[model samples]
Target chain A: MNGVKSESVREPLILGNPSLGDVSDKIAGIIESPPTKKFWALVTITSIIALQGLCSVAYTVWVGPGVWGVNNPVGWGWAITNFVWWIGIGHAGTLISAILFLFRQKWRTAINRSAEAMTIFAVMCAGLFPLLHTGRQWIAAYWLLPYPNQMQMWTNFRSPLEWDVFAVSTYFTVSLVFWYTGLVPDFATMRNRIKNVLGRNLFSFFSLGWTGSTRNWAHYEMAYLILAGLSTPLVLSVHSIVSFDFAVSVIPGWHTTIFPPYFVAGAIFSGFAMVMTLLIIARWVLNLHDFITLKHLDNMNKIMLATGMMVGYAYAMEFFIAAYSENPYEQYVFLNRAFGDYAWAYWSMVSCNVLVPQIFWFKKLRRSIPAMFVASLLINVGMWFERFVIIATSLHNDFIPGSWDYYSPSWVEVSIYVGTMGIFLTLFLLFAKFVPMLAISEVKGVMPGAQPKHDHH
Target chain B: MEEQTLTQPVKSESAETEASAHMEQPDARATSDPLAVMGDFVDPNEVTDAARAIHAAGYTDFDIYTPYPVHGLEKAMGMKKTILPFFSLGGALFGLGNAIFLQWWTGTLHYPLNIGGKPFFSPWFGMPVMFELTVLLCALTTAVVMFGLLCKLPQWHNPFQKDAGFRRAVDDTFVVVIEAKDQRFTVDSATNLLEKLGASNVRLVNV
Candidate 1:
């Protein structure tokens, strides 16, 4: 494993062959430096956008869901679609942090901390839609829980929507804990590096006064392993339960049994794309190209291509099932998606999700920075359309012909969605500024020649 | 954990004389007793060798601190496998039970509603909630127990923090500290052992 490096066999996880001290200096240096003008400018813009979203949410609560585009037949509209899209974007973080860790993919060390932060923030954005979508959000929010009320009313445990309340909250809490656990040692690194008394104290408190004792690392590794183990099924289940929100209903487009795997694949597909988009910019902005190498980008593109194909296959199977069942309503729904009122969204989903990723089959396109960046952005748009098509098209022209109507988002709805993007990016930028963008200790652990030469066994 | 001053010289060695000359102003909070004998090593392999030597010499109260978790260093130090998984299991069962009761009591017995005449309490529909709650409780419990009980962390005030050289352990240096509380420890013996094991920058510090 040591003599001569081979590219095909295994590329080095970190480039430039930096020493341990250099790793600390490079990553911690980002936090030590004052925020750049670009960072402040970006934050200001995102904060304004996020504030606009807050106003939209407040106005909706003051008025009602009537402010949005939903009508009788199109009761579930952009709100639900955005909720699923944001939640789907959150999945890639868990996949990179938990699933990849379990698979012993060493490259994850460079990206996991930031990816986990993205997961937490994306879930926050996702949770906002469902909370505010309810007309009387303040009273309706707690109604999802199985708490006793004055009227003796209890939540229906069988409802998929109620199940979503539990799944999403649990995902957020678990992800936060896992992310914090991974950050403790790195916090210690920050504590040691920061010269300011207050900054040092803050990092020290968060670091839990970590001394890096062998005894502590033993238990730390055990806790990390258990978290990764638990999170694997939890991440898969979170999306599966989200899919159940549709599959449990008798709607022709959503009633299929394959929604679970389909949604999970789409979640991972959108999530990796989102991660790629953020990381490509992050590596460039932070001057971390040596750590987050081109190989990492190439590897992520391959995963996106694979999952994109899975999403395409699911789309094909849905259409096949509709025609094969000999059910005219199901057949009409699929046909309507393709050629009816929302064919634009359907085609957009197919072209961006199905066709765009095909470029990754060529290694040059996969490895190219500009090509992958644009592809990541398009995939994000495509994934949003995928959810939009699933929810809007399915609900618009249902069994009753008289109730069908064209649905479009109000300014309020679009503002709210844009606000979520602002919220996500703002929180992410603040996190990137204050926190170590890479998992410092974990990256050091994976560096070539970081460990001892001898095998204990 | 006991603190007592060791004003008497441990040895007539030049290194001790140099370290003592360096300790001109100890922190007001630090005890005058020599808490541990310390060694700094840059290479992880050398630290692993030093840990093995110390453990083989039957000194149980020693620790090696590194910038990252070095492979095989824990085993070389003869540390025991952690029992965190068992606690995780306990938490999972507790959560599973909580979910079952929450669902069964709410759906079947308490204020049950007839939606499509579906069964009030089937494990199949309740599985998602059940699985999520289990993982949630298990993760929280593991974190709490690992930090509070096993690792005993969140100790912002530590003896090692008094020594400036100790800070380097988180960056590039590997630290081997043999506490004075160890059965085989004496300032002279510990310092001699470290130097004999090819440790550099060995020092005796009052923590």
Candidate 2:
């Protein structure tokens, strides 16, 4: 059986058998070195794209949500689709950092930093959509927050949209702190290494006088553990809350008890794909193959495969439940998703997400870098379409055929979506250039013979 | 090296007598005086062993510093479990209570309006916000309590920063520092003790 030989089949996570010093040098060297031509080229392109996104957003705000193709029935269009897509991409980072850490997965150490950075950046992009979508951000933003005023008006806490406000903001804040806490020790390392005044001062300020003392380590470990515990539920809850924006509604396809878990699974599935897309390029561009090795990619591919299957199962279950219940509305929604106006989006999602990831079930394909990269890109496209289909198809034709209209995104809406990619890439490029993209101290901890042998009395 | 080891006991004994004399006038050295005798070890194992030895030698106020958290070193150094969990729990409870009160106050008490015949406040509807706030506050409190209270962070200036050897504590070296204010501390005795415990470079750091 495939299970019988599992123990012998597993590969060493860090390839090339690099030493701790070598690992630190290779990873830190990327930050210390002058930016390469390719690095500059990538950054410039991404920056230009980010600029385009900014322009699109400015245009949208200066005009109105009318710039989008959203109409009466399809009120939530590209903005909500992109918002959910970006938020879902953000999930993989917390999953890798917090959930995997809780499970004691050591491979996460290689990618957690970059993934968390992606999470922060992706969430930043995701947060912009709802604000811009409001059409009057200045007033809507303040109105969203629960602040005391002379009128005694407060944000409706009973609404899932309000829950989104709190959930997303809290998720962002906690993720930031969690990310920074992990950075402290490495910042201390950088502070110690730098010779110049500016570098030393900047790093020292951020490092927070971390001496790596046993007492500090004791407390630091506890804090990390606690944050991990807190963030694990948060990663799940954030997406579940995002799902609540739909599930709590009485829309035909939107209302379901399975939405929370299914959304969470889809979030992680998409998130891992995005992480793979960025990291595959990064590991090659930055020459960090020794640290972010084939083993790491293989393991990540395995996760994508698993989660992708979970999503596919959820997709099938939705249809099964719809048909089994004999509810005409729910049944119609599923039928519309499959064979109606937005059927192209639905089939693309199914083929790319459900079918393509199955290639990873073969051990050979999972380990192949090029194959995995292509699959990752496909999965990302699939996941985006999954969101688009859910939002557009479900909302497009409700109960009345008289109100039905074919929805198509305007240029502004399309530009904004593409612009988010630019924003995500630009931030990622900056992070790769400036930050220690791998966990140096953590990798050191996992080195052979790194742990001290105690003489038990 | 053998001669150095042989001559250490005499020096340690004399320092012990001097330390005993100083112990009688402990407050004579003001509280503002420098705190610790710091030593650097090239090997993590050596520092871990030294931490155990120093703990066994009855010195309570001491610490080991390393680039990464050394497994089992907490137990070896006899560090007590942290109270961060309690702080997190306290924060969570506060956040949950605050969320419920705010929801109840805003929806039911302050300016309530009926929507879709739903109740003014539903606990199920409020669960998402409550859960988010609970996790948010719990994580924030844990981080604040850990970095601010326990670790005493944001003090960018530390006496150990002046020592180039101590800087390696954040890189590849391991360091052990026994506070000068400890009952058994004297410069000579602490130096001898650290040297005997395989410390490579031992020095007294003044803040």
Candidate 3:
């Protein structure tokens, strides 16, 4: 907690000035220099592969969503799962920036900028899924409205789908605003420092004419505190509502009250994992190691462990509740999930989310950056499988014996999944290369008082 | 540093000595400038009297900016939170409405066929979408309100012109700037008040 608190003090000083100082100039030089052999090769290969994936998405959108196979009982398939996964992956940023801020966690300063960026990018990836899933893809604007139709029918307000429309879109908008507001001062700092024409113009536009006056800062801090408070609940509620989508349903596994908390916990768990992954890569790529240290990774791992434990608790309680209930249908569904067609996926989820987190019990493992990185990646894979098992297993077989069907992804589904992965990594790489991967200003703000010392009682 | 309160009476000091001495009368604590009072004194021994007076009177606008954060300042100001949640709720509700609307149209209204013998309305299945949207909305609102309200988003710029020195908000410093609202807010009075309250070198910042 003290570590986190110190981060706030560090952020303002670091992030306060965006102008590429002597250090920033050095960073710019490295990224711009022509790579000799291995580095250039990796960059070229990655760009081509990502470009192809980009083309694949373009092709899918242009040619129709059918390029990815989703039909009938599995109308959602992996696309929705990916959407949930990506969106869930962003949970920690708002949680960190807002909840931790309110709690006075200063350690958040080092990670907030990148986490916020991750939130934006993850949401972007999440947004793509629905639009791509929409198939027609072009008339996405229609999804944004509530109209009075000639048939005299209005959209059902009770459905979770409608709630999702509002939740995801609103999340995207707010994250952007929050992220940009934080960036403005840094951008202004950058603008003020630039010696070149292009740099000045770009920075000036983005900085929004900031001068860092104390009054403006005071109000800005107030606004930030309020926003942080607002985002905290949004983090909890949004995931809970998502859980409701499954929980509120009559499907044997889906219809449970526990969905909201379970899903929200899982979202945060996965989101933190994603943040960890990106931050590690970013720190290495952008040379932000001092700002994002082992301490930061360890903290994130601790969160992952905690959330993972919460998820495991939920999982355990879920089975207990299911067995305790008199209903055979629900009991049978639980039995099927463990020993039935998708048993592998269910266990995979356990290993990833439940068992793997136990490793963090050792401080040495948590502190080992590479090990933490691996754990984060495994958790993400595990969480994805968790969603897949949740969606596919329950939906594939439930209620009646005769209605049972097996599900598997086709080549198109595989490619689309890969493509989304491509997009996620590509955006992340670009961000690592371009942006100040840490919240420099906010970290500087909470430093031990810079003012003249007075004798204290 | 551990803070100790000064409670000793100056009756032993001669009236002439007492006149030269700085002490925030427990009763007139509100009238003194806490910062300047500290500037006049160099000894840590004199601080207790200053702290007690600052504490007793409850100056709302003046904060204690120490080398580190003082643990219980918010309680001192009797601070109440500003309206961040209301705006967040507004954003969340908007998201919920959107989630319910979009899903209902596509699954139930746009192509209403009983697939899997499922009812036209599956509010449960809508949870994933709704959850995402709700979180999205709340986050969105938080960001917007944070800037609009907390960050003072569109105020354009800060009054502090750039000097390399002011950039230390991040690395090291806790600052308590006394606003004009302090009961003893006049430049001279505030300075005097700070000294009486045991503050050292209370500098007035105009910009």
Which predicted model would earn the best TM-score?
Answer: 1
| Docking quality band of candidate 2, CAPRI definitions | acceptable
Query: Residues B35-63, candidate 3, lDDT per residue (tens digit)?
Result: 32112222222332443355455655644
Encode model 2's per-residue lDDT on B31-55: one tens digit a residue.
Answer: 5456678776756677778888999
| Candidate 3 lDDT score at position A219 | 41
Cα lDDT tens digits, model 2, A227-338, are: 9999999999999999999999999999998999999999999999999999999888877877787778888999999999999999999999999989999999999999
The two-chain DockQ for each candidate, comma-separated, is 0.47, 0.41, 0.11
Query: Each model's C-alpha lDDT?
Result: 0.89, 0.85, 0.64
TM-scores, each model vs. reference: 0.95, 0.92, 0.70
Tell me, by lDDT, which candidate is best.
1
Order the numbered candidates by DockQ, best leading: 1, 2, 3
lDDT for A27 (candidate 1): 90
lDDT of 1 by residue, A256-331 (tens): 9999999999999999999999999999899899999988998899999999999999999999999999999999
Q: Summarize candidate 1's per-residue lDDT along B89-175 as a digit string, tens digits.
A: 999999999999888888888778898899999999889889999999999999999988899988968777656566667877788
| Candidate 3 per-residue lDDT over residues A1-457, each given as its tens digit | 2334553344332322322232333333343344447555655666676666677778877777666655456567888888889889888888887788898877787788778888888888788777777777655545444455555444444556656766776676767777776776566555544445676666666766554433344445555665676577777877776676687778888888888888989999999998888777767765666556676777778888899999999888879988999778888888888999989999999998999989898878988888888889999999999888888877887556676678787666676677666667766666655554555456444433312243452
RMSD of each: 5.2, 6.5, 11.4
| lDDT at residue B59 of model 1 (Cα atoms) | 97
